[model samples]
Target: MKLKGIHHVSAITGTAAGNVDFYTKVLGMRLVKKTVNQDDTSVYHLFYGDERGNPGTELTFFEFPNAWRSRPGTSSISSVSLRVPGDAALNYWHHRFVQYEVDHDDITERAGRLTLAFRDPEGQRLMLVSDEHDTGIAGGKPWVKADVPAEYGIVGLGPVQLTVSRAERTERVLTQLMGYTKKGQYASAIAGQPDIVVYETGEGGSGTEIHLEERSDLPQERQGIGAVHHVAFRVDDEAELRAWIDRVGAAGLAHSGFVDRFYFKSLYFREASGILFELATDGPGFDTDESLDALGESLALPPFLEPHRARIEAGLRPIGTGSPS
Candidate 1:
């Protein structure tokens, strides 16, 4: 079975309010889900995406107050990228970033596409790539309240850059185990910057890439605020997920087998260079709990956590976005 594309990228954040403001107000993504981290109920697990909170559209964060800041180096997801519609969309974002005083770089081309790079308030590195040819995961509706019009709104995920100690083992895991095919290669325009090797899903665009940058001399990355914890890849269903479970078991890789995430089923594993990866299914989407119009309006708890909802609600710091519809 072929892996569909990227499901979501989960990262760490220090303040839930900062996460909400930057993602919703500046980036214009809808805060589709406001839930607590299932494993740690006190912290918030915020999900941002296009209108429906579709699988490939998600960029999630776990907000742990007073956490250590992430120090970037090797074996970490260095940056998360989002896909926008075209050159016009890129221009619109450039103006928006300027108006909001968001730190950003001038538009640049990589892999033959225009990109606008920037950072979130929490110091998470992010970019907006103009993918006019990406029809794969472009179907999500834009948020109604977004400052930018729906026509020029951000669509879904783009290529994610991961810094690694060695590229060979990571390349094998991506190709042989994860089903990504090498697409292209480019040396950074800046001297001493590691060469970027592009890998795409079988589908080949939008939310379907793992760009490996080899920095063998750098120290291992430590995860905290502003760090990407894991990258989740999409599979079609349990049938496809089962195929992966079998494959990872046969390969003797460390993996979390079939975790029922309520909204989706998850299978997590780490690559040879210690980059965390997950295989996730696309069914039972974010609409499972809330209606399309009312998503992210209230806190949502999984069934098992329902009994402890009172304690969980009391513990989480209030995220004061007031219905991110």
Candidate 2:
């Protein structure tokens, strides 16, 4: 199958309001939509990303007010590394994190770039790597205008590393099923460090990846707020998505039936080894609500939810991606 790229990355979260605020105000992500969890109505599902909350740029969250914390283990995939522009951009973000008191780590060079480590409301380890090769696709905070040069802004998602106990199951799905070939060892995860072995979609680093590290010492990861809910790879359309579904079924694995997610169609399934996986179609994007110039100002709903707009709107908790309460 021809997987285009990463559609989006979703994670679990606790305080829905607080989580929304952090991604928007603190991280400068635009809140594109607000909706109650389709499966669990009391909770929320918030989306944050660049202008219009474009695909790949999105960082989605699911609210679980009183949920157990999942232990970080070798079984699940976590840690999404965002590809930022350069070392100078890293410095700008470092000061910004301090201003917001978000508790981010100091600058360090690793894996051939400068990176800053930090946590969300739920202790999911997330980082920003300074990369010079971006396609100039980015969105900033409302108050923070475009200051740094285009080269310093975020380009795309860098690499998504999964901490798995064993790589056999996931590796088979990656190399044999998907079209990722084995690339060699990654360098120290610090700035000015060597590059690590990277397996990408045909072209290196352009698509979603399964960066594996075997760790016997680490325990299995629990599905808690702040933990990754799933990693979605892009498909050309619904047909391609169905093909992937067929492949998973043929492999004799269980999967969540296909569901319409408005911007893109999606299906969920756990890899044989571990880690929640999603195949998303990359069309009918975020332009449905508002426009390229004005997005996230109003609530957006999928077609099914539109019929019950009154009830849906009333039931949904009012929140934005900025100004944490």
Candidate 3:
């Protein structure tokens, strides 16, 4: 099956409010949806992306706190790198982060792209690349700076890098099944990073890039409250996704049967490398439950979770509501 691009990258979050504040206020992404976790009713699932909250532009979070901290090793790829249009815009991000007292690194490079490395409040390793794709993902509150143009601001999430302890299982699934080609192995002294395996859909990885982080320095990260829960790749529809479900099962990897996720249909499995991977069907989209303009204002629950909304809302820890703070 020829894979399209990414649907969204899903990660773990601690609190509803704190997750909202960081994505909206700090990164300038919009809170497109505020919902509860389907598997676990008590926690929230937050989505942050561009104005339309389109596929390939989304970065979702599963709010589950008291999660164990992980080391920066190969058992998973933990960093989520967004993008800026140019070096000047990247410089702006570095300084802007200082306002929040967040530490960041100077500009660096990886897999043929300029990048800035840093950590979030929960130590989720993140980076921002100065790479632009041809599709022209639009609709973010552009970062306004004297030195940077609105268009040159963060274009969207460039790639969510996963550091896995082993590469074989995830590698086969990415190349053979998910349609990612082997780009190359990348090691960057500039970024102070370990050697990594690179994979992506189609050629040149113009849309979203996936890096297999195999750092000998660290071990497999434990997934808990602050760890990235799962990374989702996009599929055109059930027809396209079904092909994947068959392959995953054929490969002898037990996977969840296709499950409807409202905005998309989903299937989950742990790749041989130990990182959790999800396949999400695109569309029915962010507009499914709320109007295009009024996303994230109230709690949204899946049909199954709908019956227990009152109890779930009461159970979650409060998160920042609108904008930062």
TM-score of each: 0.96, 0.86, 0.88
TM-score leader: 1
Query: Candidate 1 or 2, higher lDDT?
Result: 1
Worst 10 residues of 3 by lDDT: 138-147
Q: What's the distance in Å from true for residue 241, model 3?
A: 1.2
**RMSD of each candidate?**
1.9, 4.2, 3.6
Tell me the tens digit of each residue's lDDT in model 2 across 1-325. Answer: 8665577888888777788667765666667766657777566777776655656677788888788887787667668876665678888888877877776898876554568888775687788876644322332323233343444555456567776766666778777776767755565344553333456673355335546665656678777866888888878888888888888788777888778877788888887676788888877777765586655556666667667667666655556443211
- In model 2, where is the ten-residue run with the lowest total lDDT? 135-144
Query: Per-residue alpha-carbon lDDT of model 1 for 1-325, expressed as tens digits?
Result: 7888889999999999888988998888998999989889889999999988998889999988888988889989998899887878999989988899988999988877889999877788999988775545454667878887987887788899989888898999999877789988888664786779998875677578888898856788878998999999989888889889999989889888889888898898899998899999998888888898888889998889989988888787777745321
Q: Each candidate: what lDDT?
A: 0.86, 0.68, 0.71
Q: Please write out the lDDT profile of model 3 over residues 167-190, one tens digit for every residue.
A: 676677787767788767777453
Can you list the residue pairs that collide in candidate 1? none
Candidate that scores best on lDDT: 1
Number of clashes recorded per candidate: 0, 17, 12
